[model samples]
Target: MAKTYKDVKIPEELFFNIKNFIEKYSELGFRSVSEFVNSSARNEMERIEDRKRNE
Candidate 1:
C-alpha cells in the first residue's frame, strides 16, 4: 500500500534555523529539514503520550 503524507507549515525563521542546524551537523544523518522535523514530531508525540500515561 502507498503511504499518504500531508504538509505542515512552520514559521519561516524556524525553518531556516533547522536547515542551518542540519547543515552544521551533517554527520547526524538527517537527509533534509523535513526528515528532522518528522523525527522530532514523532518523538514529541511519544513523549507526551508517555507523560499522560504516567499521570
Candidate 2:
C-alpha cells in the first residue's frame, strides 16, 4: 500500500538532528536526504519482515 503524504510540523531541534544525520549519511553517496532516509528505513523494515517470514 502506498502511504499518503501529510504536512507535519516538527520541532526545530528534531529537524536539526535529522539534518545532521542526513549530512553525515550524504557523504556515503546518498542523493537526497529524504530519499536516503526513506530508503534506509524501508530496507530495515523489509529485513524485519523477511526475518519474521523465515521464522
TM-score of each: 0.89, 0.51
lDDT of 2 by residue, 1-55 (tens): 9988755465878667777877886777765546665777799999999999999
Model 1 lDDT, full chain set: 0.97
Cα deviation of 19 in candidate 1 (Å)?
0.2
What lDDT does each candidate get?
0.97, 0.75
Model 1: per-residue Cα lDDT over 1-55, one tens digit each? 9999999999999999999999999999999999999999999999999999999
Worst 10 residues of 2 by lDDT: 29-38
Number of clashes recorded per candidate: 0, 0
- The best candidate by lDDT is 1
Candidate 1: misplaced stretches above 4 Å? none
